[model samples]
Target: MPICVYWGEDDFAIEKAVALLRDRVLDPMWTSFNYTSFPPEQADAAIQGLNQVMTPTFGAGGRLVWLINNTLCQHCPDNVLAELLRTLPIIPENSFLLLTSRNKPDERLKSTKLLKQFATEFREFPLIPPWKTELLVQSVNQAALAADVKLTSKTAQLLAESVGNDTRLLYNEIEKLRLYAEGSNKPLDVATVTQLVRNTTQNSLQLAAAIRTGDTAKALGTLADLINASEPGLRIIATLIGQFRTWLWVKIMIESGERNQQAIASAADIGNPKRIYFLQQEIKFLSVEQLISCLPLLLELEISLKQGASEITILQTKVIELCQICRGS
Candidate 1:
C-alpha cells in the first residue's frame, strides 16, 4: 500500500485529509486525491481497481493517488482489471489510494477473498450516526478541538442546541464561535453563546406568528429586530409570506378532507413537527376570508419590500392588517 487510505461518511475526517494533501508534506512523503463520490453498487469494482493502483513501490519513484468513487469504479471490467493488478506485487510502497462512501462497507468487505490478505494493515473508519441527544455536545467539542480551544461541556451543549443538529451548520457555527471567543478564556455560557449566535429560527418563528396574528406593530417590531440583527429585510418578508401562504394552503387542504396534519406537514416541508398537532386545532376554524384577506397584505409587503419601499413600515402595516383579518376585525 502507498501509505494511508480512508473509508467513512465522516466529512470532517475527509476534509482534514484533503487539507493535509493540499499542504503536501515533503520530507515524510505525503500527497492526496479527493474523489467526487463512491456508493455501494460500485463496491466490487472499487476493490479490484484500487488494489492495482495503490501499490508499495512506484515504477517512476513518486507517490500515486487513485481517489476511487461510485461513478469512476462502477464500470471497470473484472478480468482486464485483474491483469492490471498482476503487474504489481501485493504491497506497493509509494502509492496510496483513498476511498470514501456515505454508506459503510458491509459483508462484502468481510467476505471478499481478494481483499483478505490486505485487510491486516488496512485502516477502516466507519461513521456511525450519533444519538440525537449527544450530537450537539459532540459537535461542539469536535469544533473546539479543531479550533485549538477548550470548550466546556456545558458550553458545547448550549452551543449545539443554539444551532440545529445539522453537522454542516454546526461546523459553520463553531468556526464563528472560535473567532469570537478568541483571547477569552471564560467557558461560554448560554448568554455569551446567545449573543454570539444569531437566532434566525426565532426570527423566522416570530415573523410567522406576527403574520398569523395580523398584529402590524408586532410584525414591524419583529422585522426591525431582524434588521437590527443584520438579517436582510427582504428575505424576512419573503420567507414569512411563503410560510404563511403554505400554512393557508394547508389549512384549505385540510378543510377539503386532507386533514392529516402529518401528511400536511410533510407536504409543506415547514413548521415544527410538534406544531402539526397544534395546527389541526388552529386550522379547523380557519375561515376562507382569513386566508384571502391576509394573502394580499402579504403580497403587498413582498412587492413593497422588493420595490424598495420602507420594509419596516410595510411589514408593520402588513402585520397589523393581518391580525385584523385573522381576528375578524
Candidate 2:
C-alpha cells in the first residue's frame, strides 16, 4: 500500500490536504500536528522518532497528528520501510499519521505493502498553474469555505490576484478580511482587497503598491527583504523595469483595439492568459513616469550597493526615496 502523498506544485492543494488530515487526527484539546523528517541516511533516527510518536502519553491529552515531511524513503535496502510495514498493524488509534512528501516509493514497497490498510485516509495533492486566476479564486473560496466564511466570486478573484502564488500570505490575508467583513456591507473588490491584503515584504509590485499608497515605511521594508533574499539591486531594478515595459506594451496593445483576452495575452507574450486578463484591467492605474523613475534609481542603487557603502542601508534609502518620489512627497 502506498503512503498517502499530497504531491502538488500548487501549494494550496498540498496545504489543504495537510490541513484536513491535521484536523482529523489532532484533538483540539490536547495537541496539534507534530512533524519529523528523514534524509536517506537518517533512517535509524527517523525510525526512532516515529516510534516515539506511537508511544502512549501518561498524562491526559488529545490526539497528536504526525506529519513525515521529508525527501527520503524511510525504508532502505535493508527493509526499513518493510519493517515500517510490519509496525503499521500496531500503530495506536490515539495518534494520526500523515505523510506529505514528493518522492516515489520503491515498487516492492507498493507491490507487497499493506500501508494503506492502516491509514484512515490517503490522497495526493494537485498542482495549479501559477497564472490560473480562476482556479486561484476557487482555491481561496475552498479555504474560506473550510473556515465557514463566505466570499463572492469577484472578491475571490481580487484576493487571488493580489495574493498571487503565496498560499501562506493568502491564508493570512483571508483571516484579516474575515474579521473586517463581520458586519460591514462592503464587499471584497479590488480596492478593498488592496487595503486588506497588504504585502508584508517588498517585491516589484509591493514597491509599486507602496508607491501607489504613499507608504514609505513599507516600501523601505520591501527593499530590506529583497536585499535579505540575496536579490541584487540591479536585478530588482531590471525586474521592475521589465514589469513597467510589459505594462507599457500591454497598454499599447490595448490601444490597438485588442479587446479579447486571448489576443491581449498573446500580444503581451503572457504565458498565462488568466494573468493577462486581469493585467488588462490594471494597466490603466500606472503612469509611465513611475516606471521611468524606478529604473534610474535602481541603476544607482546597483552601483552604490556593490562599491560605496553598507549595501543594505543604501538600498533601503534608495527605495524609500523612490517611494517618496512616486508618491509626490
Candidate 3:
C-alpha cells in the first residue's frame, strides 16, 4: 500500500514524479489494466479515483490510481470528502494512490488533513525562485542528468537564466541541446546553448520590458518574432494580461505598506519570493490604475483575435498603443 501525495506549483516535477512512480510500481505489460489517471476539475474525479483504488490488481504488478488535480482539497463536498477519508485507508495492499495538485493543499479542508496524515510519502515541488541562481543551476544540472547529457555549471546557469522558472521549457531546451550536441561528444557550453535555445519565455519578458521602457522598435521586433514563430495571439495576450495583473498586485501591496518580498509573493501567489524584487522594479514606472487599464486593452485584443481579426496586425497595433501608454504619450 504505497500511498503518495505530491503537490506544488512545479507541475513538470509533479508530472515526472507521477511517471517515475508509475514505472516503479506498475508493470508495463499490465499498465493498461491496472493504471488509471484522473485530471483536474472533473466533477467525479475524486470518487472515480477512489473507486479505482478500491479495485484489486488483476495481474502481477501493483495497481496505481493517479489523481492529477485532487479537487477534494478545495471543491469536493464535505460528505464526499469524508467518504474519501474513510475509503482511502482501506485501499488494497497491492494498490497505490497518487494525488497531485499544482496548488498547495488548503489546510482548512478535512480531506487535505486526512491525506497528509495517511500518505506514506508526501513530496512538495515548489517553484524555485528566479533570483535563486544556484537552485536554478542545480535544476538545470538535474535536468541534464535526466536527459542523459552533460552541461557545464556555467552553461546550466545561463540556460536557467534564459528560461526563468518554467521547468517544462527548461527541460525542452535541455533536450534540444542534447540533440544538438549528440554527435560532437561535447558538454553543452554557454555559446552552444545561447546559439541553440530560442528562450520564448525570455522573449515574453523582453516584450514587456520593452513596452514599459518605451522601446517601440524592440517591442515590435519581439512581437514579430513571436508572431512568425506561430505563437498563438490569445496566448500572447494572456501572458501579458497575467503580467499586468501581477504588476497591479505589486502596486496595491506596496501601497498598503507591504514591503516584505515574501509577503508580496504570498499575495501574488508567486512561487519565488525573490521574484518580488524584479516585480517591484518592473512596476516602479507604472501605477495601479495604469495596470488596470492595460487589462481591458488586452482583453479587447483577445476578443478581437477570437473574432477573426488579423493576429499579427492586431498584436502590432496593441503593442504600439501600450508603448505609448507606458510612455504617457
lDDT, candidate 2, at 130: 37
Which rank order by TM-score, best down to worst?
A: 3, 2, 1
What are the per-residue Cα lDDT tens digits for candidate 1 across 1-329?
43334455566656666456434522233322322223445555555545545444423334434344332222335653464355234444544444444444443432223333343223444432221325446666877788766667776766654553445566777778778778987766766676777553445546666656656677667777777766666656555666566667667667778866667767756434555666556555557667777778778877888898986667666677777777673
Candidate 1: regions farther than 4 A off: 1-172, 175-202, 270-275, 282-285
The Cα local distance difference test for each model comes to 0.56, 0.59, 0.80
Query: What is candidate 3's lDDT per residue for 227-319, written digit by digit as tens?
Result: 776666776776677677777888899989988998898888777788788788877888777777777888899899999998888899999
Q: lDDT-based ranking, best first?
A: 3, 2, 1
TM-score leader? 3
Residue 237 of candidate 3: its Cα lDDT?
77
Give me the runs in candidate 3 sitting further than 4 Å from their true place. Answer: 7-11, 38-45, 68-70, 102-104, 122-138, 152-154, 161-166, 180-186, 198-202, 230-329
TM-score of 1: 0.45
By lDDT, is 1 or 2 better? 2
Separately for all candidates shown, the number of backbone clashes (residues 3 or more apart, or on different chains) is 16, 4, 0
For model 2, residues 1-329, the per-residue Cα lDDT tens digits are: 11344444456667767676556655555552343333434556546645755766433443343445543233444454665666667766665445555554443655224444555555555544333445667778877776555677777876766665567777878888888777765555666666767643345555555654557888777767767766556555555555555665676777777777777777766666667756666656555565566667766776775686777677677767767666762
